[model samples]
Target: MSPQPQAAVGAPLSRVDGRLKVTGKALYAAEHDVKGALHAVIVDASVGRGRIASIDTRAALAQPGVLKVIHHGNAPKLPYRDNPASNNPPDGRRLRVFQDDQVLFHGQPVAVVVATTLEAAQHGASLVKVEYDERKPSTDLEKAKADKPTTYARGNAEAGLRNAPVRMDLTYRTARNHHNAMELHATIARWDGNKLTVWDKTQWVVGTQTELSTVFGVPMDSVRVISPFVGGGFGSGLRCWPHVVVAALVARELKRPVKLVLNRRQQYFGTGFRPAYEYRLRLGSDRRGRLAAMVQELDAETSSYEKFTENVMYAGQMMYSMPNVSQAYRTVPLDVNTPIYMRGPGFATASYVIESAMDELAAKLGIDPIELRRRNEPSEDESTNLPFSTRRLRECYTTGAREFGWNQRRAKPRSRREGDWLIGMGMAAGVYDTARMPAQAHVRLDADGTAVVDAAASDMGPGTYTSQTQVAADALGLTMRTVAFRLGDSLFPPTPPHGGSMTMASVGSAVLDGCNRVRQQAIKLAVEDRESPLYGAEARDVIVRGGRLHLNSEPARGETYQRLLTRNKRSHLEALGSFAGPAAKERHSFYAYNATFAEVAVDAALGLVRIRRVLGVYDAGRIISPKLADSQAIGGMVGGIGHALLEHTVTDHRDGRIVNANLADYLVPVNADVPDLKAIYLDGEDPNADPLGVKGLAELVMIGVAPAIANAVFNATGRRVRELPITAEALL
Candidate 1:
């Protein structure tokens, strides 16, 4: 069959839901108006690790409009059924809400106050008092003991290190980070007899449904989850948090709908955040700057109750080629909330250590940073011994370097200065696994010439609605406006969680399949009918454009969908699309690659760093939406700027309390911090990755950004600050 014309896929289209959003007509989770819904506020414990000694709720019960005050002392015993298949962390039991007097972390919910109004709920919550037997919590990551180390090794790293000509050992620390999405973590849950309905701000509706069903000991069919809009996730909403269960449990007890919204401060403890990491890296390289061995020791923070682990060792095993590699990754259990996947998750953290180490090695060997990376580039994925599905990193580097004016950068540190500012450029190579999971989508084409495609996916500011609509419109041979995409509902066709940059690769493939089948059904009907203009034409030879089925050989031989369906008395055409994920034994190692460049100016006297410019060249399979891809890339770089110089979540080791839990205390990059930024996608597709030909872009864009900025800082001021959020004190 002839390839579909490139009309919508690569086009820079505006978001279809922009108008609805700007007009404030789009409903988010907490915005849903549930009549007679009561408000619930949780009372947090003062101590981190302790046992509740006494609870006094008499004063709260006396408050007007207060419906009920429930605590562990009086709350009913929940089923708390185990659900390993859910997004819960592995090996450890999830925190059972209001099931015991034990306090695992500071700000743990000790009790809940339900009131007829939000104001009353707040007043009641403040009136309730709780006393605890406090214990000194081990919130400090450095002091906590790490669990059994997970090890990975290739050749003998010790022998390789001993034989190498040059070596360097470095230790780096990254601070904890919060998601801090625009919208609060909110849920409105209502129970009708045995059935439960919830409107939540979440990334995965089906996952939430399954979690809630399992938690309440109810069948999955009895739970319905809806989330039409999300302000932003960045990975915070990936799991169903404890507050969601609290809302549902309270609603079931009161026999009325309950609305619970965490304030900005409560969000810090209510939702998951990126864990702090301590990484020690040792690199052995030849005189030519070729990596001979790499030994990585990693320790990350996690909650005492759950074992939360990410792929932090992945980049060490595969990012750059090395004859010998060894890794040990351990999670240090602390009196804190369980960590969850943040933006780039493991790849972003590991890339910072590896990429920065590579830059250091380049300086030690007196070679250009880009040249050093090029020297160690492997022909295939050495870790898996499989050829890459699409490895255009060389092209990305060349393009990014050229476009970023790499030739202007001097090899020496602090070579260029403007007044008190020293300018420098740095670059890094990034890789993220191209992951695709089984997904299903449903596409329906009505006789009115409009279509709707449904999938249980999420947008989360990545333009899933616009991109999926583009895919469906092109596949069904319709204009972009004629097709509508719907998501974030459990009733829609099931899809993988809208994270890990896999939505386009997985859900989009299913959308393409379904739309094609529906369009093919129409062509089949037209070609088989004797009265149709496309009669007797081969199905492959027939193409649909603007809802008209026409012979490819003869453009004039065609009929509109309205004419054909109206004449045949067919109401609509529908089909279910699906994509089977990777096979048991994969033929290729699929990964998205990026070459990220950054220019920074640092004030030596003041220890202030300013970003001059950033450029990211991506070899991310295919460009689904260029405009949206640009937004994603720019946002990723801005986030990296925050991670490099602005953002940090501070925890007080004395009592295990988050010192800076609000936005005013914790900082992120603002418009002033970001200057000129550009994103370039190498024009290409990887048929081996998925049907949509898109490698994940969201996570890939963020992976190498921090390292690039950090490397630039080193070049600018001749300061190699190993810790993230390189404050002025470290630079000075």
Candidate 2:
């Protein structure tokens, strides 16, 4: 069939839901007005570990407006049937809310008070008393024992290292980080007899539905999750947290709607965080800066109950060409909550260590960093021995160096200075695997030349709503204003979780398929109809544009969809589209690549670092929306700045409690902290990646940011801190 006119797909369109959001019409999870809903406040455990000895709820129950106070002593035992489909850890049982007196971690929810108003719930929760058999907690990564290591070895790394002339061993540490999205993690649950519905802040409504069903031992269809709008979610909302279950359980037991919203302090322990990591690297390279061997040993923090892991070792194996490589990744189980993916996740942390090490190697060999990296560029992914589908990292480096004025940088550290400030420029390369999963979308084109597409996806502050609309608009041959895209309802077509940077490639492909099918149905109807214009024309020769079907060779001979559908007495045409992801045995390695450059000014006397500028050149495949892509890039750079210099979740290891839980103590990059920032995308497409040709930009943009800044700090100050949040004390 002839292709539809490509008008809206690449256009720089604003968010379709922008006006609704700015005008206060868009309802977030907590904003949904459920009638007669009670408020619930969770009471946290004071101790870090050990079982609860006694609980007293007399004061809470006596409080005015307090409907019920539920705790382990009085709460019913839930079925919590196995649900392998959800995002829970595969090897361990999930924490069941209010199931037992066991205290797994500091700030564990001991009880919840439900009342008519939020104020009453808060007051009642404060009045509740609890005593615990406290035990010393093990929260420090250095002090805790690690689980069995997940080992990988390709060649004789020790022998290769022994034969090489140049050898270096280094250790790097990254502090824990919180998601800290503007919207609090919240849920409002309502039950009608056996059926349950919840308005939640989540990245995957279907995942939440499945989890709720399994927890209550009910049919999946009986639980419906609705989340129309989300302020932000940097992977924290990917799974159903314990607080969501608490809300649902309260609603069901009390036979009334219940709402629970975690406050800022509770957010630190209530949800997941980016775990701290200690990575030690031993490398052997020739005098010419070509790597010969590498050995990587990493220890990361996780909860004692569930083991959490990320792609921390991929960079060591595939980022460069090495004949011998060995890796051992061990998780140090501590008295803390399980960790989740935050922004770039494991790749970001790995890039910092790998990129910083590359800079150090370049300094040792008197070689340019970019030239050294070029010399070690791999012809294929050595881990899988698969040719890359589209590896434009070289192009990204060239373009970024040219754009960021890399030639102006001085090779010597602390050589360029402006009075009390030291100036330096640095760059780092980044990569993220192109991830895709099976997804489905539903489409309906009405007789009025308008179309509506539905998918069980989410827009977690990345403009998913607008980008998907663009795909649908162009594929259906309709104007952007005429196409309506709806998501975040479990009743819609199933879609994969809205994280992993796969939403556009997976969900957008499904939407394109649905719209294309609907358009073809209209074309077939118009051509076969005896009373229509150009009735005998071949359907293959017809193309749609502006809601009108016409012969590709003779555009003037056409009929509007409105007239054709009105005459046929049809209300609308519908179709369901799907994407079956990649093949079982993938033949090619696919990944998005980027080169991030940073310029910084460090106060020589005060030891303060100020970012002068940042530039990111990405080789992520086809960009569906340029404006949205810029937004993602800028947000990522800001987040990276925080990761490098400001953000750190400080834990009081004595009690396993996060001391800097609130925004006042935990710092982030603000407008004043961020200077000039820019993003450039290479114009290309990878057919093997996905139907949309997008290799996923959100995560790639963030991967190299922290390392770039860290390298710049080293060049400016000639000091290697080897830890995140390069503080003034470390520099001084």
Candidate 3:
């Protein structure tokens, strides 16, 4: 670590770029003013499983302003070198568009029409006619069958379940969820000879660069993915989807830049989504509320061409101290588009069922819900057999119970009521594995004493730009105003995907690296230069404050950064900081924990559960920016509300097509749905986690939120609904 300036790291500061967002000056992927960029529209497959039988581009090619049509028969064959690093595509076979006529699933990209205008391309896509020799598609998870299952076993669960005094066997279902970011998925591709420049909505620029390089068979240096502003990506933008490739293909064929943007309807089917899951759990516990054994069977939706599996059973193996455990997670590859990661991924789905089961056991045994969970908290991650870097779940439970007034919750259902509403409170524990990835950042101190920090990161509505600015301000000897942070472009230092709650811990460490390097360089220059005030001072004894380097004992005797740079005839100083990852240690367990509480008002007659208030208290290491962290917590809690009450992607099931593919049909949480929400971050930092002592918070905020609310609804009505979107119909 390099020496840095003194500024508050945890103080609540306003977003640095809030003005740009409110004024609409921030350039999203489609908003980038690319001149003369031809518009392109993609035509998706109407059938779930089929193959094109004949060529029918005559009508589309004849449309006014329609430049050309690219399909499987006439499109270029891309060189897709298997780069497993950024290709988080869990399924081995990547989706290759326009290279073959074999249709893998419904809504697969079949053809792309390029035109002089967007409207022309849109109309041209509608004009394209196709006939397919269709086959009966297996879109139903229960009906579709596969080979042997992936299994995990510890001690004999059969023997343990036999010896247990009490047991429960139940099944839970969660519907598919779309990302539905405010800004739709868009791509603008421009090719200059062999070099390609693209404006894309991506979470990871370096990852996107790697994937595009593999797709185009070009060197990594030849491709540049620039996206300075992203509206939001729960996990939808993690991979390079097919539309990005179509835009690039159209640009290369026409010898002109091409821009393709998916509308709200296209967004539902075009981008990836959270796979619907069917989980069956058989849990055995003693009369004392101690877990004895567990057996879990997990099945999720995937595409026919690939295998997509979520860590849906990860939390079950490690959360509680169970002696015997057996788990099997498998994917039912259906004739539907492949599912990508959502906000919480596997854990969110798993948490809902596991927590619900725990609540059930508490009810059966006539014990308090919190007391039941308190008896099962484990000391370490039993599955990995490795100590966590820092686990604070106990503190979360202790503090959250007091703050949310959990002690007042009634142990029996329908114990409280308000008019026609059955009022109740519920709380649940949350956990997320703090993922870390390698990232880099560049820092420079100009002669004017203002520092510039550049990294290939993004805000994504979580305030990455603002939080990183705070980190830089503290790392360098400057106020928030003197330090400027820039991100969302590949030209800056490379970074990983912005999801997974790892951005803060990974990217903040990188910014700390660069700022510390810059600060050290200034200190060395000032100490060695005879004209400096602290020329003879030891480097260790000198510290920076408010952009000035001074001695520890004598604060008044200092050298301004501008003075040192001007006298040395030095224009500026630069440094690059990076974090490779921490060495694995054995002493302490490491996991960020949260305690979420929800209050619901269920109408006894109508069976409609309306959330009135919600609160989340998190024990994530150190908070770099309080405001940004609060925003993350609130956003996550709001997403949780959506998970519990709304946000369901309904599939027609008749023809294996998503029936509600638009925002109007598919529901998300509206302003009226979310009323009072609160996020609280515990004041603490773990030295072992990273140089910045900050664990990521994006994913942690949304974990177990749905389960918490569902449990609360049960406390209100004594109705245990296993399926998600616990809609009015289910309650009724």
Whole-model lDDT per candidate: 0.91, 0.93, 0.86
The reply for model 1, stretches above 4 Å from the true place, is none
Q: How do the predictions measure up, each by TM-score?
A: 0.99, 0.99, 0.98
Across 283-305, the per-residue lDDT of candidate 3 in tens digits comes to: 89999989999999988888877
- Evaluate residue 337 in candidate 1 and report its C-alpha lDDT on the 0 to 100 scale: 84
| Model 2 per-residue lDDT at 703 | 91
**Candidate 2: 10-residue stretch with minimal lDDT:** 84-93
RMSD of each: 0.9, 0.9, 1.6
Worst 10-residue lDDT window, candidate 3: 1-10
Which candidate leads the pack in lDDT?
2
Instruction: Give lDDT tens digits, candidate 2, residues 1-732.
Output: 677788988788899999999999999999999999999999998888999999999999999999999999999999999888875453677889899999999999999999999999999999999999999999999999999999989899999999999999999999999999999999999999999999999999999999999999999999999999988999999989999999999999899999999999999999999899999989999999999999999999999998999888888889999999999999999999888889997899999999999989998999999999999999999999999999988999999999999999999999999999999888999998888999999999999999999999999999989999999988988899999999999999999999889999999999989998998899889989999885999999998889888899999999998999999999999999999988899999989999999999999999999999999999999999999999999999999999999999999988888999999999999999999999999998888988889899998888999889988988898887789989988888
For candidate 1, give the lDDT of residue 375: 93
By descending lDDT, how would the candidates be arranged? 2, 1, 3
Q: Residue by residue across 169-220, what tens digits does model 1's lDDT show?
A: 9999999999888999999999999999999999988889989988999998
lDDT for 626 (candidate 2): 94
